[model samples]
Target: MISLIKLSEEAFTLYRDQILAIEKASFPSPWGARAFLEEARNPVSYLWALRKGEHILGYICFWMFAGEVHLLNIAIHPQHRRQGLGTALLKKMKSFALSQAIEKIYLEVRPSNVAARRFYTKAGFQERGRRKRYYTDTGEDAIVMSLELLDRSESCAERCGAAGVTFSTSEAQKDLEVSKKRIDLPF
Candidate 1:
């Protein structure tokens, strides 16, 4: 059974190795055990894991504060790339953000990571800015991408083509049916 669930202490304990492996494989310089542990303890940080039965497949972590979400990390296992898992995880993230009154979601990626940059753009994220030498590992410039989850004047449908998806900062859409082609939302 494939499922997406919050990474509880029990799950983290059981799958720490796998999760860490995914991170290491997905990035040039990955977070170590301490970083994951710190995030788990942070009140504003949320980490979610996607699993297939007992095997961990991927995860997403983010910080939510002040009407914004800063996506700290997200990665799908190498073997699972291009299977729509990334899109599903992103949809879940967007839904959760909208419910929490978050107005925007932001993330930074290496400018050289064209694949990730493309994915974010397809998911409705726009290049907001660039940071000089954000990645300490290789001194690579990071491109900031942002997604507006809600607007005061327009519906999400108008901006991203979710059709009936509409919400304000105060009210969140309870249900968002994410369709691959039907929904214009990038991920």
Candidate 2:
């Protein structure tokens, strides 16, 4: 019963508390409501919330730039983890990226977050590289991942690999209006 919807300033106040609650519940060092508010007002940013009826269960944020989208944050409430909410949110993100004409999508996840890594792996994202001491609070390394634009119209799992890599197949592949691109950011 999870649905994805664009988040805007008008609906910011309504979901602020819920978003914060999920952030705190999911992350060791959580972002506050004010931080989320600031990002919502950023022109380069887009936010989406996973909601069940009136309750927000999780959220994703990204920055769009020059035909690419960089995932900023994605968090699901601890109580609702492993219910496919994250996957649904990522699918929505890919749809949005394709719609925006983005050919590359990227994200950074803590190296220790095996579940998230596996989730992304199954969603056609591949590990490309690593950033040393990327998490300032914990001094933890981050694994960079990206998804390449495919000619296929469906989601597909990517082969395991390192970063700064590219995969392309040009055999009469149909262009899809998806909103996700595999991406990586150097830390």
Candidate 3:
């Protein structure tokens, strides 16, 4: 069985090798241990892993602040691609954002990465803009994409009422849900 779990500094340390293996395999300019280590230490940054027992098949790293999410990195092991894992991870993040009343999510993909762009488009993220020379490795331009999670035109009361809960921004900091069957745990 697979589950999603929040990664802590210790978790990152423990899974460094496995995560790094996927990282290096999935990207052209992969992040090294130092980058994950830094995210583990950063207060606003969050890392979530898709785990099957002790092995991490995939993971996502992002930053949340000011009612917005900036997805920094996401990757799945080569063997695990095309199995809906990427979409699952993205959906998990979207749900988390909605739970926190986050308004939008922003991410960047290399213009040359058609697969990623297609995936994001299928997931409801629209092309918003472009950044010049966003990829330092190959000087490739990056296409910015964004997903609007909330209808800000509506009041909090209306939105929260529809969900049968009072609007409370404090819940944004509430822990991720957990269940033994398939839980999202925070360490």
* Tens digit of per-residue lDDT, candidate 3, span 1-187: 6666667766677778999999999888999999998997789897888777577889899999998999999998999898878877776676667777787999999988898889999978999999999999999999999999865454534333221211111111224323234333221
Tens-place lDDT per residue, model 2, 1-187, is 3445566655656677888888887788888877788777889998877666678778889999988889989998888877766776776667657756778889999988888889889978999999999999999999999998654455433121212122111111133211223333211
Q: How many backbone clashes does candidate 1 have?
A: 3
Off by over 4 Å in 3: 151-187
Worst 10 residues of 2 by lDDT: 164-173
Q: What is the lDDT of residue 12 in candidate 3?
A: 72
Candidate 2 deviant stretches above 4 angstroms: 155-187
Candidate 2 deviation (Cα RMSD): 11.2
Per lDDT, the best of the predicted structures is 3
Model 3 CA lDDT for position 178: 30
Please, what is the TM-score per model? 0.79, 0.77, 0.80
Residue pairs with backbone atoms closer than 3 Å in model 3 (clashes): none
Question: Against the true structure, what is every candidate's RMSD?
Answer: 8.5, 11.2, 7.5
lDDT of 1 by residue, 12-130 (tens): 65678999999999998999978888887788998877766567788889999988999999999999888877776777678767767788999999988999999999988999999
**Which lDDT value does model 2 have at 41?**
84
lDDT of 1 at 118: 94
Ordered list by lDDT, greatest first = 3, 1, 2
